[model samples]
Target: MKDSSHPQATPPHPAEDVLDHLGYRLKRAHAALRGAMDQALREHGLTVPQYACLEVLAARPGLSNAELARATFVTRQSMNVVLRGLQDAGLLTRPATVEAGRARPASLTDEGRRRLNAAQGAVYAIEARMIETIPGERLSRLLEELDGMARALKD
Candidate 1:
């Protein structure tokens, strides 16, 4: 029994503590990764989202705005702003007239490829640094676990 006037301070449960919370740890890791990528991308005048769009466009060739929005985990309006910036910088292109649907499919330009190539080295280095922090034997498991977690939560 505890007194109502002066309640005892409860000891923290290790598993239930905020420091051990999965969501908190995930958010912290995400922020660290984003910050690192942002720093690496700043020299090239690119934001993390812009670089993500470029990377996706490079791999997929021609993706509609909405498709890109989904792939990048951004709103269509936000993606439009990113696309406009990239287009203005001559890093990507869209058809002057929509020949098929309302969505404008975007493709990387020669400059876009060049820029992506330039940034890839730095980005890969950052990834390598992160991977090096984990044990070699656990790397695959870590990746699989992350993918599984994401899949489980996606509804």
Candidate 2:
């Protein structure tokens, strides 16, 4: 017989418990990575969001702000803020589009491209240092699991 009135009478959930533990660890790891990357970028006058905007613009020149928002999984308003900061820094340019009446094409300047390229090594180093263990197979599996979770959540 079980005592339902007892606070400890509940059965432990294997799935939820594992997810909670993993989520906490993942958050902590992400915070640490973000902190290190932010510190590294500070000297260059860049934040994580700003760096991401530069990278995306460098990779896909002439992207509209809306398209950038979609690609970056950010709101258009939020991306506009990033664009403004980058533009103010002379790292990015948004020229009025000749093809469209009101659409502006976002592109990175030479300086922006150079900075993005320079940051790549630091980004790679951070990722490598963080995921140095757990083997390649496990890392791949973890990535797959995360992708699956993303897909499921999106639906």
Candidate 3:
């Protein structure tokens, strides 16, 4: 017979509880940040997704839709819609394919570059406002942790 006084039990962990709890708070924080970005971009006639695409193209020119999708962490179909929208806006261009039966690779147009440049200050302002209260070291740690988490998740 088992002793009633001694019971098998799991260890207590407030850390595990707060892990998901803090995650929920982080999601809300991200939504707030995204909303601010969306509003700032809207003033310049761009959505957050479109701005992300523009930033990706600006950094790495001549990306195919597949590569762009990968960079944006979006599905190919969603990227196709983004590409079509940007193309329609004359903010991006796709060169005629050099290889047989291949689609043209995409790049940002001069106008797109100029617009992105113009919006740079506002974007920085939004980011700054969000992190302004945070200490530099704390912000650095937060960024490192977030990037590490993202890499882990990707893997």
TM-score of each candidate? 0.88, 0.80, 0.81
What are the lDDT scores of the predictions, listed in order? 0.91, 0.81, 0.84
- Taking all chains together, the TM-score of candidate 1 against the true structure is 0.88
Scanning candidate 3 in windows of ten residues, the lowest lDDT window is: 10-19
Considering lDDT, which of the candidate structures 2 and 3 is the better prediction for this target?
3
Which candidate wins on lDDT?
1
**Tens digits of lDDT, candidate 3, 1-155:** 98889895654434565445656768988888889988888889988778888999899988888888889878989988999999999999986556755656888899999888877778899889988989988998999998997898788
In order of lDDT, best first, we have: 1, 3, 2
Q: Comparing 2 and 3 by TM-score, which wins? A: 3
Off by over 4 Å in 3: 1-20, 96-103
Report how far off residue 36 is in candidate 2 (Å).
1.7
Candidate 2's residue-wise lDDT over 57-94, tens digit each? 87888888888888877899998998988888889888
- Tell how far residue 14 is off in model 1, in angstroms: 4.6
Clashes of 1: 0
Backbone Cα, N, C clashes tallied per candidate: 0, 0, 0
TM-score: model 2 vs. ground truth? 0.80
Q: Candidate 3 at residue 30, lDDT?
A: 89
The per-residue C-alpha lDDT of model 3 at residue 2 equals: 84
